[model samples]
Target: MEEEKKTVRAVERALEVLLCFASGHEWGLTEIAGQVGLHKSTVHRLLATLEDKGFVSRDAATDKYRLGLSVLELSANLWRSDDPSVALLPEMERLRDQLGETVSLYIRDRAERVRIQAVQSKQAIRRVATVGARLPLSVGASSKVLLAFAEASVREAILSDPAWPSQLDRSTVGKQLDEIVTVGYATSFEEREPGAAAVSAPIFSRSGQLVAALSVSGPSNRLTPDRMHEYAPAIMEAAHRMGTISG
Candidate 1:
C-alpha cells in the first residue's frame, strides 16, 4: 500500500511538471524540478521519458525543454473531431448569410469563455471574432448569456474567484444578467471590443440545460439598439434550432 501511494505521488508530480510547460515557457531541468518540488534527478528522468514518447523535446543549444510537435498534432486532431463547433458550422454559415454579420458559437470552460466557431459575412467592413479565442466570463454578450444560464454553483464559483477580471461595474452586470435570464437572450451595446455590438441567445439541451451560446456581431452603427431588438427574434429562433439538432 505504501509503494502504491508513492507511485501515485510520483505520477502526480510528473503531471505537475508537465503542467508547468503549459505556460508556454521553455524550462530547464532545475526550473521544472523547482516548479514541481521534485528532486532534479527525478525531474530529469521524467522529462527524458516524456521526450522519448515525443511529448517533450529539448532545444539543441539552450538545452531547455518544451512541448514537442507531437503534442500539437494530437491537440489539433482532438480539436477537429465531432466538436460542437464543427457540427454547427453549416447552420452558422446560413445564419451569417441571412443576417449579413458575423456569427459565433461559444462554450464555457469553467469561468472562461471560448469561441469555438465563427462564420463571417462578406460585407466590405466586417467584425471578426477569432475561433479558439478565450475571454473572461464577466464581459461580452456571449459570455454574459452563458453566465446567466449557467448553474448557480458554477456562477458562484466564478464570482468567488478573487483573480477573475471584471471591467464593468459588478452590480450593474448582476442587474443586467437578471434581465437576460428573464428575456432568454442577451445584447451588448458596444461592450467588450470597441465599436462592436452583438446579440446572443442561449442554446439549451433537450433536458433543458444550457449547453452553449450563439451570437451575431457587427459594427455598432449597423447593429444599433433598435436593430438589435429587431434581430433578437431571429437569433433566438436560430439558437432553438441548434439546440433541437444537437439534442
Candidate 2:
C-alpha cells in the first residue's frame, strides 16, 4: 500500500487565513476567525506572523488587516522572469525600425551586463548584438547606465574592487554618473569596441527600481555624438514606456 501523505494543520490554516484577503477586502480578527473556522486567538496569531513577514498589513485605527506589498513583490518577480523581455520585444522592434539601428535590452548581472534581447538593424553595415552575450559593466553606454542607476552599495562595491581599472578617473566618472541621472540617458563612443557607438536609457520597475537598460547601437560613423544626442529623447521615451509594463 502507498504511504499516506501528512499535512501540517497549522500551516494549512495560516494559508487559508491568507487566502481570505484574496477577495480584496480587509478583515477584522474575529471576522477572519469565523471565515477560516478558527478561534479568534488562533487567527490573531496567524495575522501577527503574516504581518511581521510583510505578507499582510494592518490598519491600526480601523483594527483591520489587508494584503501587503510583499504579495505584489512575489507576483512581480514571477512576471519579470517569464514575461518582461517578451513584453518589451515589440517596443524594441519599433525602436529599431524608427532609428535604423540595433536595439538591445541589457540587465546587470554581478560585474557584467547581459544582453537578454536584441532587435538588429536591417542594414548590412549595422552593429550586430547577440542575445545572452555577457559584456563588461565598465565602458558601454548600457554598462554605465546600469551602474549609474544601480543601488548605492552595489555601485560602491564594484567601483572600489581592485578588479576594476586602477587608473579610472574617479572624479570624472562620478560627474558622468551624476549627469546620466540628471539627463535620464547615457552615451558612449568607441568606449567598449572600436567603431561602435550607442545611446542608452534606464528602464525602471513600478516600484521605481532600475530594472534594465534599453540601448540603440550602430557604427560610430553612423551614430555620431550629435546623432546620439538626437536619439536620446527617443531612447528615453521608449525606456519610460517599457518601465510602465514592468513590475
Candidate 3:
C-alpha cells in the first residue's frame, strides 16, 4: 500500500520568514507578513518561536524584528575552517586590479601581522605597505583581525601583556576586537600611518583557526567611507570564497 506524503506548512513559513531578512534590514510583524504572504497572527507566532530559539530579536522601541546573535555564530563557524592562502592569492590580485587599491595578505606572527603577499595599486597616490613588513597587532586592521579570532589563550596573552601598544590602550583595543568578531571585518583610518585608510577581512584555516587577514588600503581621501562600503562586499565575498577553499 502507498502512503500519502505529508508536509509541514509552519516549518516552511518559518524559513520564508527568515529569508525576508536577507537584505540586512529589520522588519515589523505586518511587514514580515506582507513579505512572506502570511497572516499577521501566523507571522507573530512564528516570530515568537524564532525568538525563543535565539534566531530573531525584536526592538522594543520600534517593534521591529532583526536577525539575532545566532546568525553571527553560524557565520563565525565558516571563518573557523580551512587554511585558504593558495586559493586566496589569485582572487586577491584580481580584487586589487578591480578596485585599483593595494591588496595585502598577512599571517599572525606572535601578536603581529607579517605581510606574506601583496598586489599594489597602479595609482601613484596609493598606499605602499610592502611584504615581510611587520606591524603591531594592536593598531592596524589586519593585525586586529588576527587578534580578534585567535584562540583565547593567544588573545588574552596579547591584550593583558604590558607591551600592548602605547598608542591605543587595552580596553579601547579590546572593544574594537570584540566588534570585529561581531561584524566579521576590521577598518583602520590613518591610525597606523597618516594619510592611509583601509578595511580588512579575516582568513581562516580549514580546521577553523584564525590564520591571516586580507586588506585593501589607499590614500584616505580616495578610500573614503563610501568607497570602503562599496568595496567591502566584494572583499568579503572573496574572503568567503577563499574560506571555502583554504586547507
Predicted structure with the largest TM-score when compared to the true one:
1
lDDT of 1 by residue, 1-247 (tens): 4664335866777688788875646999888888888889989999888889888999989999999787888888876535678777888888898899999999999878988889987899888878778888887889989988888788767766786665556667667888999998888887787899999999987789787999999999999889988999999998888887776
Full-model lDDT, candidate 1: 0.85
How does each model score on TM-score?
0.73, 0.67, 0.63
Off by over 4 Å in 1: 1-68, 76-82, 164-167
User: How do the residues 111-220 of candidate 3 rate in per-residue lDDT, one tens digit apiece?
Assistant: 67788778889998889867667788877878878888888789899988888867677788788889889988888888888899999988765678666788999999
lDDT of 3: 0.84
- Residue pairs with colliding backbones in model 2 are none
Stretches of candidate 2 above 4 Å error? 1-82
Off by over 4 Å in 3: 1-87
lDDT at position 210, candidate 3: 65
Instruction: Count clashing residue pairs per candidate.
Output: 0, 0, 11
Q: How close is candidate 1 to the true structure, as a TM-score?
A: 0.73
- Specify the poorest-scoring 10-residue window by lDDT in model 2: 75-84
- Clash count, candidate 2: 0
Q: Distance (Å) between predicted and true CA of 245, model 2?
A: 1.2
Score residue 79 of candidate 3 by CA lDDT. Answer: 44
